[model samples]
Target: MSSTKNENCYIIKLGREASLSERANELEAAAASGNCRKLLQLIRATGSKKSDVSETICEDDGMPVTNSHRCLERWTELFEGQFN
Candidate 1:
């Protein structure tokens, strides 16, 4: 039934959330201990390949922005303003 499918989806989501939380805790501990290799491993494990953006761009104020989400958000705002 649809309800059973929804319950299965919810359980899967919860399992993923728990796994991410555990990885985050491990990452925090690694960072506190200055374990760069373990930190990078945890980061890579927690991050998705599809979300990886290696390109660096500049913000509107000329500050360098290397984060993909921030770059996308800035560009979206700029384009939205031009259209509106």
Candidate 2:
């Protein structure tokens, strides 16, 4: 596998681990806490090619978020929607 592919796999693994651990809320919070953007940027910078890393923000419902910003939005919706 190529380096980029390896990075992608690592990210996916991280997401899966987070979801399996039932820490979606904490993950979502961390993602929306501004640091995620920086971390995402660092991850992107390490890649030789541009590829979407949104899959790294796996939703608890099995829905895949396709962008960092949208990931945050979806998490907000999922959490807040619970009350409505």
Candidate 3:
């Protein structure tokens, strides 16, 4: 589980473990182009309303899970109660 944290948001990686600093660097580099739409797209596509990106970082509860549309959808539905 990896996570990127900023003042306003946290983006967590579902499939692997990466340091917060590394995730932050990746986001910074991606944002340097002045277009973070791709970043937003990924978040909008995968984020869970209840569990949040922070969930991926705390694994003592369980190991980090993989990233797939199906997994995201299931998680979203379980957490937010909205699935379509």
Candidate that scores best on TM-score = 1
The whole-model lDDT of each prediction reads: 0.87, 0.71, 0.54
Candidate 1 vs 2: which has more TM-score: 1
> How many clashes does each candidate structure show, in the order listed?
0, 0, 0
lDDT for each residue of candidate 3 in 3-83, tens digit (9 for 90 to 100): 335522433443234564556566666678666886675455445566645444213356665566546665765667454
Assess the local accuracy of residue 55 in candidate 1 as a C-alpha lDDT between 0 and 100: 60
**Stretches of candidate 3 exceeding 4 Å from the true structure:** 1-18, 41-84
Model 1 spans with C-alpha error above 4 angstroms: 50-84
- Candidate 3: worst-modelled 10 consecutive residues by lDDT: 7-16
TM-score of each: 0.54, 0.26, 0.27
| lDDT for 34 (candidate 3) | 65
Which residue pairs clash in candidate 1? none
Candidate 2, position 37, lDDT = 72
Ranking of candidates on lDDT, top first: 1, 2, 3
What TM-score would you give candidate 2 relative to the actual structure?
0.26
- Candidate order by TM-score, decreasing, is 1, 3, 2
